[model samples]
Target chain A: MIGTFVVARRELSGLFMAPFTWIVLLVVLFINGLLFSSFLYQTQGNVTATLSESMTGPSFWLWMIFLPALLSMRLVAEESRSGTLEYLLTAPVSDAAVVLGKFLAATGFLALLWSSSLIYAVTLDYAGGPPDWPAVIGTWFGTILVSGLFVSIGMLASTSTSTPLLAAFLSMVSCLMWIAIPFLAANIMAYLVPLLTSTAAEQAVLAERMGSVVASMDALRHFSRSFQMGVLDTAEIVFFLTWISFFLFLTARSIEARRWRG
Target chain B: MIEVANLTRRYGALLAVDDLSFEIGRGEVVGFLGPNGAGKTTTIRILAGYLAATKAGRLVVAGHDVQRDSMGVRRSIGYLPESVPLYPELRVEEMMRFQGRLHRMDRQAMRVRIPEVLERVGVQDRGKQLVGTLSRGLKQRVGLAVALLPDPEVLILDEPTSGLDPIQRGEVRDLIHSLADDRTVLLSSHILAEVESVAPRVIILHEGQKVADGKPAELAASLGGGGHVAVEVMGAASAEDMSSLIGSLPGVESVATGERVGIHQSFEVRGEGDLREDIGALAMTQSWALRELSWQRPTLEQLFTRLVTGRGLDELAMPVASGPGAAPSSKPEAGPAGLSADAPVLASGLELSQGPTGPSALPLGTPGNAGSKIIYSLNPFDRGASRDLSKPVSVDAPPEAPAEGLPDGASEETES
Candidate 1:
């Protein structure tokens, strides 16, 4: 565990020295700030009301995917590319510690990026409106959970390959697969099994129940409204936690798999 | 400090390291010498805990099983990989600090130790330089500093002086020698001289197997055929007369003459026992001048080439600056005991191409003919070919350039 922290601290300091990190920071801030000003313009400059919705909307999920993918690509890929993976793993540190340290570093950077949204939270509070502060905080937790799961997937992708570009491509692919595959599977089932749709009477009730069961597996149900409204749902948090573990489990296995080669 | 038994590492269908085993006692410096792809790096990687050995093998580093207690083994060993992977963005001190921390050093200990280690490796002035910007030599020094961090009980360096210049190689060799008083160091290098300078004991690997191990000079002598002796003969009738005089001695293998100057000639007496005293006694009875007598130990390169590829030392001792037959330096190789023991004879007298500084053949090489021959040996007292300036070896131009102009062109190119 201490190894994990040591690696994380060094990795964080390294990120600070990287120009790419600052570039990402500048670009994300510029774009989000533009969006915030546009939100004000759209609301006729009413900053008090549109704060929470603007803070946790589609732009936030965009941050969830692209920003974390960029940060996590280097977590495993750069180390292996630079051959520093040998140095890191051969230290008196376990595979889990190295992987977890890198994952936490990426997550930590994502958290720093997300903290910029707190400026919006403060704006809402300062504007003297009855802001949905609980929803803001709950959705903030949900955002991190979502980001962690995505970054873990990115890190898993990075662990599978030595090239940073391939790692980045794999991370993007993995994130999209995680976010879209379940819904795609359910949609395909709905189309192929027309009988899964409701008709009439008892058979129709069973078909509708089955369809709803499959649809409930869609990721949208958890975060679409309940998380957006700051309902603090345990189910969404658990889903993120489970998926994050699954990605991290695959990542640790990937790291160990490299031990087989030169 | 290190032990291995039946240690084998296989990469799928290929055996990278065979059932190899060797031991190094505490504070010993062992050089791992091998041709490329000879399992030197693979074995070092296994010892350093970078790669795990196959289940059939047993490797214990510093008393910890490599495969079982790798972390404990790693804690005791500092490894410098062949490629010297370093974070380019990090300064030397920063990298050392990070390595120190990774080794579990405390904040206060690291603060005091980083500068000390950086200075020890002679990179203290470059501590603030980014590793990417430093020369290969300085990078190697920093790599050494990193390995020296935490004061590891065992140090594993792979080709520590591989790509550096001779001067840099000397610096690294001196550093490795300094490390020998306390830490057990296992280093691998293709530079034979660098190995000769630091490691008294060497383990030579050929095709993933241990071919030879022992004191380097002993190995060279035992496997390197009979060592040769440099004998300058005077007051003898002819070259054959000198050959017969020495060849009759017990343990005398063959007699090859060097620079046949009239009544006097230098003979390389190849064989076993100390025939010098016997030759001196023969010269005493025969009323000949036995000006110089010295033994030349067979070089490790000869032993290694013979063991690895069944090639003769003369063929393998091709000029370092040029390929075989083409001498790297223009310096004549004859007069003094020839570096290429069989260097081709030139017009009038013979001119020899400078190669490995052969054993001294003194009183024969006169000073005025320094242009014809220059003999350099580790022995400072290597008296020049018998100072008898009477029958001087002709200091002519280089051996005839091949009729084809390309030989001349190659020499000109090398000069430029």
Candidate 2:
């Protein structure tokens, strides 16, 4: 546990010290702030609708996808490139501790970046219309869960390569597939599966099964359906948590594999 | 403090560290010597717990089995890799503190030990500076400081003085000597002089196998011949006649002519024992003016060449620079004067290009020059062989050509 925190502290300090971090933060916040104000204006100051659209909207979702990659790319790739991974791994810390520490630091930084949205909550109170507190809280929780999964996936990508640019590009492509695959899977089941099945009854059953599976894997649907409207589902939270653990576990295994391969 | 037995590490079909075994007692400092691709770094990495051996037979360090208790081994050992890697963004003190925390040191203990280690490595004043901002030498000191943070019982340093200037190398060599007094240390270096000065026991590896292991003096003595005795005389006879007189001495094996200035000619005389007195007596009898007469002791450099290439310096004692039969490839038509003055280096280069011999002279395990060529063929990525082959030729080439030809040409240009 101490090893984890020590690694996390160093990683956090490193992230904060980089000029890229500030530039990303400045640009991301500036863009998200504009999108938030524009959404509120279009909705005529309707806090509940604006909060849902701003938090789970397409623009914000795209930022969540790439932001984690940008934040976690340097976590391992840069260290390995600089040859510092040898020193870090030779320490008394376990591979799991190193991986988990870096994951938590990146997730925490993303959460902090998201926290700038609290100004929207402040703006709601000051403009003579208080925001929907339960909706706001649920939206924030769903955002963190989604961002944590992205960060863990990005970390796994970071561990798979030594070049920071390659790691970032790999994680970005993986995140894109993660979101786009469900939609593609749905279209395949709806159109491509029917050509193979002769009976209408058989096609209906197969399409329903594929739809249920794809719907469950769709992260945006989970956020938009329940958490966006102040509904917290235990199964939704567990789904994201399970995927995060799976990726992080693979990351630790990749790090341990270098010892044998070298 | 360290023990390895039958430790074998393989990459695909290539064996980086072949079946090797050695032990270091508590408070003993051992030097690890090898040519390129000899598995020096691989062995050091395994002992430090950064690598795992394919067949880890009884590998132990600091009373812990490296395979079973790697954390314990890591905690008890301090390692400084050849390339000293540090976080450029972190302050020096912050780096120390982070390393301290990783070792599970308490706040009170870290408060005292961090500064103590900083002072020990002579970087006490640079604690507030960023690691990336410091020069290479200062960064190396910071690396040493981090390695010392745990006050480890076993220290493994690989090429500690690799990139330092002469004075800095001297300082680091002295520091390693001081640090070795009470702790068990395993140091690997390409610089034979540094190893000869610091380590009483040296283990030389050739082609991932242990070739020689003993004290430096003992290793040199086992070659069974005294070192060369250099003499300068101003005689009335011609240089060839004077060389013949020295070569005819009782114990003198051979004599190679050196630089001639006016009427004074220097001769390097090799023999069974010190031939200075014999040469001096002959010079006095012939009424020759003896300018200088000194007997040189056998060096670790000669021992290494003999063990690695199976060719002793005595075989390389021929006057290649002036001899008519010298290989054309051995001559560097355009090179620095310093390299042209290095006759033995040119001779070794000539010997390496000779390739392997048929089954005649010696068996496989012997220090035959055949073993080196075979080993070079075994690993295509062997940097040592390539470096040794090109090293002399590159030095012979214009110095600027190498700098511009390197892969990091852009960085060199920017630096200049």
Give the best candidate by lDDT: 2
Docking class of 2: medium
- Judging by TM-score against the true structure, name the best candidate: 2
Q: Give a tens-digit lDDT track for model 2, residues B47-88.
A: 888888889778999999999999999999999988898999
TM-score of each: 0.79, 0.83
Q: Candidate 1's residue-wise lDDT over B21-86, tens digit each?
A: 899998899999999999998888888877777753568888898888999999999899877888
Clashes of each: 12, 1
- Candidate 1, residue A112: the lDDT equals 76
The worst-scoring run of ten residues by lDDT in candidate 1 chain B lies at: B319-328
Candidate 2: stretches off by over 4 Å:
A190-198, B234-272, B317-416
lDDT (Cα, tens digit) per residue for candidate 1, span A1-262: 9989988888898898889889989998888888887887788756544555466667876666677778888988888988888888788888998888888888888777776766777875677644567676766666777778888889988888888888888888766765676667666765655564454475556656666765555555566657667687787778777878888989998888777677
